[model samples]
Target: MRNHTAINTFILLGLTDDPQLQILTFVFLFIAYLLSITGNMTIILLIFVDSHLKTAMYYFLQNFSFLEISYTSSCIPRYLYSLSTGDRTITYSACLSQLYFIYVFAITQFFLLTVMSYDRYVAICKPLHYVTIMNRRVCRRLVIGCWMVTLLLMLPLFILLLGLEFCNSNAIDHFGCDAHPLMKISCSDTWLLQQMVVICSVLIFILTLVCVVLSYVYIIRTILRFPSAQQRKKAFSTCSSHMIVLSISYGSCIFIYIKPSAKDDVATNKGIILLNTSICPMLNPFIYSLRNKQVKQAFTDLVTKLYSSQGTREILK
Candidate 1:
């Protein structure tokens, strides 16, 4: 066994350990990285520049863009670098920082989604009082609360990880320093950290899922009373996007960490990791854009304007 002090960097066993697949993996993830950045950045810019999008929906859209970018950026760059250079090694400090921020961004996303659900709930169920209920002050406070609370949640997890002694194991059997995969590297008995992770995971699951379920329940109950068919259709369309996003993200996260036992075998757990870190980010952009007509129009408008302006500039030149 290697000495505890000898462990300084970790060799990541990325998506596939097979060197033959590195180029293909790099190409695939690079495409995902491009789409995720471009789509989310466009959403953020749209929310910023579009005067019509100054409402609560767009405010939360901005937050989601920020979260998605931070979350995806935390891992994808490293994964892509590893794929391209065929260097999967990460220094101890770098890995620790990556792990910390991954959890931080994830926690932020959980609360942000919950806030979005509450926003939808108010907009739908309490339409008459929506403006007053979701006032500027209230919305700002809720957004701040989500960020602060997520930071708080990340503190204990980072401390717990720091205390662990990595005596021998240096291979992380995943693309990133995912909680479950990182835990496997601890040579010290990880019963306590695992338990802490389980409790934290459970809290996010229960808290966020309960909020979403309650919000949707209220929204649906109110929708049932809508007299107009168009109104009902609009309500369903609005909630469908949130429901799909919440389900997929939470589903992948739970599958990876909830069972605890399943996390031990990296080979089997690879699918779960892929969904949470890679697939979920990519899906968020397309899922949201495809389902929302306004966004589709906005995207088309952006593209058309771009090409039109280019042609004009060329003619003038």
Candidate 2:
């Protein structure tokens, strides 16, 4: 009896077959890993130290920065290790765990973005109710809810993948563990679970998309009604950052899931997933941190204090 798709583990092909390319890929990913970790960590450290950043917005942002770092670390570093060593094997349990965490981070991030957008809407569109609506209690609960919902939604992918028996092929084409790409290799009919994936994807997408759109819609309307040029500029500046992130984030997700099938464009689909995982996390800190006056000031003051203290230590020495 031949094993058709009974793969206990998978050999991740990584980026390229060429030896030179493997080295290049490793170098590039290693640098990416470093920058992503360093950049996200700096935000977390600054947010932690600066009392100025203790507000609801930065709190959500802190969670986001942490998630970004985790998301990339889960996929890229493991892929880098496999590519560099040429031993592409991933244990069955490892692959499942990877899949679960990927969804946890990704789905949670989307919901978190949605929550952030709603927070902005309250702050901008309804200033009177801003504090009342987005109180510390509410924000904390909502953030926690995002994490919970993402974990619950991601369970189905594991359930489906686990039940299926792989006959022979155990190679995952991409650099890391991906649910869809890995599913494509199974001998069993995955159509039953495609609906689950679609439903989860749509629920996540629709909720986030709707909230983001409605927030912006009101935000735009409110900005238009304002007579002061300063107010208009402030509104536009604040909203634009959220808009940029929402567009890119949802666009990648919807583009990938809405496709007729995941098998249609394995490389391109993985590329888009990579984009969502790679660029979005790094972009959040830059977009959210730099644009807001409070975060910027906190960042500046923290750096200034650190350097100033260092100088004082040298003088004292």
Candidate 3:
């Protein structure tokens, strides 16, 4: 039997070892990270400042943008830093911390997406009661509930991971400190932890997916029943962006986490996860803004107001 010594740091085998690939990867990720921050931040700012965006839909969207920022920030920056500097060694505590935040932010996002689906459902199906059903107090409670539920689910796995001792192999075969990679390299018997991971993941995935699907089913049925074609078109426009975002989010996650074959293809999984972390977050704000008329209008109004104010200041000077 090999000696199992507790290690303070673990090495990350990043996306590629080729110097050229590393540079390309760094540049791509840097741009993606920059765009994601800028886009999501813009959404948050617009929602906060725009009076027209004070409804429940924009409120949920604002929270969702924040979650995207937190989730992407939790991992991508570290990976980019490693690719740039060749510093692959991450302290055990930092690794665990990364794992915790990634899971928390990601899981909470799933819940928030589910909630947003419900919000869309209410807005389309029960428009008369939408305001009463999704009041400010209820929205706040739902956001808090998502975070609480995530923490409860993650605490068990995180505590169990802390008890594990790493021995022979300290090289994680991924860019970030993911649970599966960490568990794979541990000397301890991780069967229980592995089961817990799968169970938690499957439970969250199945539950949230069911909620989203059901919400859309009702939403679609209601939209179809509209008497006028114009009304139907307008209703579809309201939620189409959300539907697209949902497809991308759920599709990527299902491929990465739920597929049995994913564990075997570590390299492919890494690529998919890179897209999930960087591209998806970067694309989401664009998706919402480009497809949303109200958001576009809000952006235009904000810019015009700023321009007029600047002109006034210049004249006064």
List TM-scores for all candidates, in order.
0.92, 0.92, 0.97
Give the candidate number with the greatest lDDT: 3
For 1-317, candidate 1 gives per-residue lDDT tens digits of 54445688888887676777777767777888788888888888776766666778778877888889899899889888888887889998898889888888888998999999999999999889988988878889999999999888878877888776776678988788866767777777778888888788788879988999999899999998999999999989987888898888887777666765543466667756655666677778788789988777777777888899999999999
**lDDT (0 to 1) per candidate:** 0.82, 0.79, 0.93
Scored against the true structure, residue 83 in model 3 reaches a CA lDDT of 90
Instruction: List model 2 lDDT by residue over 213-309, tens digit each.
Output: 8877887888899999999998788777777878888877778777665455766776677667776776777776777787788878988999999
Candidate 3, residues 14-126, lDDT tens digits: the string is 88899999999999999999999999999999999999999989999999999999999999999988997899999988999999999899999999999999999999999
Q: How should the candidates be ordered by lDDT, best one leading?
A: 3, 1, 2
> Cα deviation in Å at residue 290, candidate 1?
2.0
CA displacement after TM-score superposition, residue 132 of candidate 2 (Å): 2.5
Worst 10 residues of 1 by lDDT: 259-268
Off by over 4 Å in 3: 1-5, 262-264
Residue 161, candidate 1: alpha-carbon lDDT = 84
Of candidate 3, the 10-residue stretch with the lowest lDDT total is 1-10
Report the CA-based lDDT of candidate 3 relative to the real structure.
Answer: 0.93
TM-score of 1: 0.92
Model 1 error, position 72 (Å): 1.1
